[model samples]
Target: MSEVPTTRPARGRPRDPGIDARVLPAAVAELAEKGVSGFSTRAVAARAGVDRRGVHARWATSEDLVVDALATLTANLRPPLTGTLRGDLDDLVPDVARALSGQRRRVLQRCLDEVGDAPAITERFRRDHVDRCTAVLEDAFHRAAGRGELVAATTPARATEVLMGSLLLRALTVGDDAVRGDALDGVVDHVVALVSTSAPGARS
Candidate 1:
């Protein structure tokens, strides 16, 4: 009689739990230097010092890979809330500003430059980045409104755009180093003032 062969195949080595910690940042670095058009798994593999299989095994599409990479950069933009809207904004707003500089700024610039040609990337940006920001702001703003810290009319969309855009503007216009920590104080103060002085008639 012939011996029966085992039906189940041998399992491969267990995946490195820290592969994301390595690949995502490398993907962002590739995007910063090459933009979307030039972005490639091979380049990222070389930069990350891992086989292309490691990256591809994790992310099936470039869009998927890039969005996850961008997520890592944007992940820390949110700060812990202090209940009071002003205190929350004090930390949250500055955190957003600080993140908009340096290599992260380059990543954003590359995304903006090439995203128009890539609808998949555009949708990913909205789903992963824009929508996340809006959701967080909506929670913060509505909570503040419930407590009478912000006007009931406060619109998270316009406010999110304004606050986030202002911080991003500095990095785009004057480079990352130009975004001063002190200047962010003014942004928070002005927004708080808008709620106070114009709360009744505020559009957002």
Candidate 2:
């Protein structure tokens, strides 16, 4: 009998990289229907056609799972980068306003309205959505700067907050009404004008 060569089996199940990617869209879709308060792991699992064990296997906690899902959804959205800062911002602002008016926006608003004392969810929103997008927008602003479309003195972080805050405030101001595209355009135009005008030798 010939001696059989044996290979040791790899330890544990190989990690599924696509698991989170697969699970997240279903989660976001569910979250869009149900606010953070009403979000359910079982429902998300059902929607994804996966068992709860699959979700639990990937995320240690529901907060972590939700954050990851929200982040993934945000990532899939492509923020436009036009050559001019105003044009680029004009492309981005409408999306921001729509998010403010859409199902996700209502879910988010519901959670914020009812859950001020819920530290876990609140902190997760702050860290996951707000901070992450702020960083992304800041990087976008830096890219504009590299292209010489932004003022040399422009602070990316502050600029991001200003642009985002305007949309947020406008959404709040209008309550449930759909924010008009013109309104978003106006906000983008205003911010871009402010930044561009501050640059040395900029056209009047």
Candidate 2 wrong stretches, greater than 4 Å = 1-22, 29-34, 75-83, 140-155, 175-180, 198-204
lDDT of 1 by residue, 1-204 (tens): 998887967586656778888888889999899888888988898888887887788899888888888887673556457877777777676557666778888888888888777778879777878678657755666667767665555455565666666667777888865565667677666676666324455553
Pull out the clashing pairs in model 1.
Answer: none
Report the C-alpha displacement of residue 20, candidate 2, in angstroms.
Answer: 4.8
Error of 1 at 125 (Å): 2.4
lDDT (CA) for every model shown? 0.73, 0.69
- lDDT, candidate 2, at 104: 53
Q: Which pairs clash (backbone N, Cα, C closer than 3 Å) in model 2? A: none
TM-score of 2: 0.66
Best by lDDT: 1
Clashes of each: 0, 0
TM-score of every model versus the real structure: 0.83, 0.66
